[model samples]
Target: MTATAGAPAPSSTGQGGGPADDAGKESADTGPISAISPADSPVSPVSPASPTAARPLPPALPQTPTPSPEGSRPSRNAPVRLRALDGLRLLAALMVAAYHYGGRGGEISQAWGSSPREQFPTASTYFAYGCLGVQIFFVISGFVICMSGWGRPLRSFFASRVSRLYPAYWAAILIVTAVFALPWVAFKSVSPSDTLVNLTMLQQPIGVDRVLGVCWTLWAELRFYALFALFVVLPGANRQRVILFCAVWTLGAALADAANQPFLELVLMPQYAPYFIGGMGLYLIHRYGHDALAWGIVGLSFLIGQHYAVAELWHAPNPSFFSYRSTLGIVAIVAFGYLAVALIALGKFHWANWRWLTLAGALTYPFYLVHEHLGWVVVEVLHQKLNIPSYGTFALTILLMLFLAWLLYRFVEQRLTPVIKRSLTAVRVR
Candidate 1:
C-alpha cells in the first residue's frame, strides 16, 4: 500500500456511467454541473471513500453532518474534485468505440479468434483489440461508487445516482429512437416493448431485447450501484465491512465461474465484478495505504478471474476456453489494465489532466450511449451502398457520433441534470 494522497478534494464523483458517476446532485461545489468554462470547470479526479482529514465542503451546501466511520459529521471528509479522471473516462469511451468500429459491432458474442493479427486483415486491425474498454469502465464504476457514497446519507446517495444517471439515459434513448425513426439510416424495427424496456436499462433479466447491444453494461452498472447502495445503508458501514463484502463477492464469482452458469453469472454480476472489485481495491489502497486485504483481493481477482473474464467478455469462438488465444496473454492484459485504473486514481496520470479533456469525458456517457447502433447502421450503408473505405467510414462515423454526443451534453443533459440537482437540494433543505 502506498500513501493515500490526493483523494477527491471535496466536490466530485458523478453521474454513474462515465467519469461523471454522480454528475448530478452536488456534482458541483457551488451549483450542480456549473457552467464548464475551461478556467472554472473541474476535472473531478476522484472522491474519498470514507471520512478523514478532507478539504472544505462547498459553502452553498449546508453541512448537515451524518455519522460516518471516522465519527461525527464534522469529521467526515468532504468530496474533492480529481482532475485526471476525465481523461480516463474519454479513454474508456474511445476504446469501446474503437472496439465497435473494428469488430463487426461487438456484442457479448464477439470473438476475435486466436490470432487478431491474422484474422483482422481489414478494419479489425483497428477496432478488434479495443473491447477491453468495457473492463476499464468496470474499474471506474467501482471507484466512483465508493467515492460517491463515502459519507453521504442513503437518501442523498440514491438521489445523486438517480439525478446523475437518468437524464442522460433518457436523452440517449430518445436520440437513438429518433435516429431509427428518421428512416435515412437502415436499422432494425424495434418493438414498442423493447424500446420501453431498453430505456429502463434493466431488460436482460426480464427477457426484453435491448435497443442496442451495449445497453447490457448499463444494466450491470445499475445493479452494482444497487449493491453498493445497500452497503452504504446497512448498519454501521465501514471499510472493513466493504472488504468483507468484496471477499464474499469474489467467492461467489469463483463458484459461478466453476459452475458455468450463464444466467447465474449475470444475476450475480460476477463475471464483471472482479474488475469492479479490483477498482475498489485500488481506492482502498489509495485511501488507507496498502493493506494486505486490498492487495490480496486485487491479486486474487486477476489470478482467479482473468481467464474466466476473458472467456465471457470476449466469448472465445471455438468454445474450448481461451482455445486459440493465449491464456497467459489474456491474464497479463487484464491485470495490467486493472492496475492502470488504480494507478490513475492515485493522480499518476497527470499528463491526461487537461481541462479541455473534461468536456470529452463529460461526453463519454452520451457518446457511449448513442454510438453503437447508429454507427452500425450508418457504417453498413456507407460500406455497402456508398462503398466507403473502412478508414473513411470509421472517421465519418466518429465525427457524427461526436456531434450527437456533444448535442446531448450541451443542450439536453447539462440543462436537465442541474434542474434535478436543484430539486434534490431543495428536498434536503426542507
Candidate 2:
C-alpha cells in the first residue's frame, strides 16, 4: 500500500474499494504500531481518510495517529510485516525470564564455582549476559519510536506515546502495589510510602529499590523517551542532530565511568546509555535504508559477543580496567542496533511469525512483570512443602510463573488494553 501526503493512494488490486473513492471515506488503518483514524490518515491507498482532488505531500501528513506506538506504521501499497522484530522481542524477554530463574536457584553461582575438571558445571558464565536483552529492547524501541514520530508534530507524538505506555504501566503499578498491600492486610509490616514512591515511578530517583524489581528498566526506558521527545521538539532537529546528541551522551557516560563520577548518573547511566544509543543509531541506519548489511553485522556480533566477549569480560580477574570484554560489549551494541534496523527494513521475517512464538512474545511484558514475585512464591512452596531438588524446584517455579503470567495476560492485560486505549483517546479528543 502506498500513501501520499496524508491521503491514501487508490487500491490497485480489485480486492478493496477504489483508492480514489475510498480516500474520501474514513476507516481504521491498523498496523504494527499505532493506528491512524481517518483524520490522522497519511493519504495513501490504504489510508482510511477520505480522498481529495489533490493529495498532500508525504512530509505534510496528518499529525495525530489512531494506533499505538507499539506497532509499526501502516503501508499504503502492501501489508507491513515485521516478524523478525517480534522474534527479537521474544528472545529478549525469554533471556530476562531465564536470567531471573537462573539467579533465583543459585544456578549461576553454582556454575561459577565449577572448574573445567569439575564433574558437573556449577554456574553458567552466561548468567550476566541475559542483561543484553534489555539492550535489544532499547534498540527496538528507539527505531520504532523514531519511525512512528517521523514528520509529526512533537506534541502529538509525545501525546500518542504517553497514551500508549503510561496507561498499561500505571495499571501494572496499581496491580503490583495492591499485591504488596495484601501482606499488610494480614498484619505484616510494609512501608506504604515506599510503595507509593514506586507507584509514582520515582523510586529510582530516591535511591529506592523498584517496587517491582524489574521496573527499574522501565524507568530507564521512560527517561530515554523523554529525552527523545525533547530532541524532536527542538527546532530544526533531524536524525543527524539526534545522532550527535547520542554521541555526546555516550562520550559523557564513558568519561563518567572512567572518573568514577556520580554526576553523570543523574542524567545518564554509563552502562545503560550504550544500549539506548545503539538503538538510536540503528534507527538512523534504517531511515537511510542500510538494512541488509546491518542485519548480517548484528547477527555476527550477537553470536561473538554472547559466546566470546561476554565470557571473557565477565570472567576477568580484574574487570575494572578497559578490557576486551568491554570492547566487545560496545561491538555487540552496534551489532544489535544493525540487526534491529535490518529487521525493520525487511518488515517481517517469516520465522518470527510462528503462531506459538508470537503468542509467547505477546505475553512477554506481563511475564516480565509478574514472574519473579510469583516464581519466588512457587519456589518457596515447593522447597518447603514438596522438598524438590534445587534445580527441579527452580524449573517448576518457572513453569508455574509462566502459567500464571499467561493467565494474567489473557484475562487482565488483553481485556484492559482496548479499554485503556479507548479511554485515553476519548480524553485526547476532549
Candidate 3:
C-alpha cells in the first residue's frame, strides 16, 4: 500500500490505475567518442593490467590524463573490469525495490490487511529511505558512462545505450501491460496508444501516461545520455573539458533552482544533477590519479546532492507516513552513497571482484524495470488469496522478481542488444 516516493503517478493516486512519473567534467584531448572499440577496452578482469589502465583517456589529454612516457601508462589493451560496480548496481536496484514495496505509506495495508510498518516494523524504518536509491543509480551511471564513453565515438556510445536500455525496457513494458490487461488483475491497464508511447520512452515528456511507474527514471537517464553525447562525447573529452562540464552543470543547476526557472530546471535537473556530476568526478579519479580538481568536484557535488535529498524527503507524498524522516538521516544516506562510489573510484573495493557480480549487475536493469507494478500483484496474491504469511509473501515476491529479471536478461536482453546495436551503428549522419 506504500506509494513510491518521488515517483510521479500517471493518475491522481493509487496502485491499479497507472504508472507513476519519475555529470562530470573533463578536459579536451582525445579521439572522438568512437575511437575505442570493444577490442580497445577488453572486459576480462583477469588481465595483468591495473584497473587504471582499463580506461585511460586519449593521448594528449592535457592536465587531466596526458599520455605517460613509455612504460609509464597502464596498458589499455588488457582492459581491467570493475566487477565491484556491477555489485553496487545490483545493490541500488534492490534498495529501490524495497522502498517501493514497503516504505511509502500505509496503503499497502489495503492489500495485506495490515500496515507495512506493522508487518515490517524494523525493516520499514530503513526501507523508507530506499527511494534515494535512484540518486545512487544516477551517480553510478555517471561513472560508468564516462568511463565507457571515453575515447569512444558518439555512434558507439549511442549504440551501447540503445542496446542496453531499450531491449529490457521494451520487454518490461509489454509484460507489465499484459499483466494489467488480465481481467482478474486489480491494477489498471493502459490503452494501446499509451502502451505505444511508453515504448518510445517519451511518455513523461509528451504527456502520455506511462505503462510503469519506474519509466520516469528512464526519461531522466535519456536526458543525461543526450547531454553527455552532445557536450562531452561529440566534442572529444579530455580532463580539462570534463572538469569544465561538471562545473558549468553544477552552476547552471544552482541558478535554475534559485531563479525558479522551469525550463532551466527541466534541462538541468537541479535535484539530480549533483549525483551524476559527483559520479563523473569519481570516474575521473578512477581513470586518472586523484587530483584537487576532481576531488573538489566530488565534494561540491555531495554537498549539493544532500541538500536536494533532504528537500525531496520533505516533499515526498504522504507526509504523515514519513513523519519519522529527518534531515540528518537523508543527508547521511546520500553521503554514504557518495562514499561507496568514492571507494570504488579509489579501487578500494576489490573484494567485490567476483565473476558472478557481472551477472548480478546485468539482472539489475531488467529487475528494476519489472519489479514495481507486477510485484504488487504477486505480493497481493501470495499473501491474501493464497493465505501465505506476510513474511513468506515478501520473500517469495522478491525471489520471483529476481528470477523474472534474469529470464528477461537472458532471453530478451542478450538476444536483442547485438541486433539493436548493429542497427543503430548502421545509421550515419549526412
Task: Go through the candidates in order and give the clash count of each.
Answer: 19, 42, 22
C-alpha lDDT of all candidate models, in order: 0.54, 0.43, 0.64
The runs of at least 3 residues in candidate 1 whose Cα sits more than 4 Å from the true structure, single-residue gaps closed, are 1-80, 105-123, 233-237, 256-266, 313-329, 380-388, 424-430
Ranking by TM-score: 3, 1, 2
Model 2 per-residue lDDT tens digits across residues 1-430: 1111011221111101100100000111111111111222212222222222223323323323324242334333322223344445555655555545442222222222322112123433343344445545555555445545555566555554443344334555566556545652221222566666666656766765454555555555566656767766444235456556665766676677678866666466665455445545554444343444333333433443344224323435453421112555535643664565455443334333444544444444555555544444454556645777666765677677667657755676456644554454454433
Residue 344 C-alpha lDDT in model 3: 72
Best candidate per TM-score, number? 3
Q: Show where candidate 3 strays beyond 4 Å.
A: 1-78, 315-319, 427-430
Q: Report the lDDT tens digits of candidate 3 across residue range 16-50.
A: 11111111111100000111112111132222225
lDDT of 1 by residue, 1-430 (tens): 0001111111111111122232222331101111111111222323333222223443332233333364312222434344455555566666667665554322211222223233345645445445556666666656556544555567666556556666767887776677767766445546776778767756666776556545556666666767777765444346776687789888887788679887667656666677667767776665555577878877876665575545644444554332232445456656666767667655456445455665665666667766766666666666556877656766888888889878877887778866775677565434
- Evaluation by lDDT, superior candidate among 1 and 3: 3
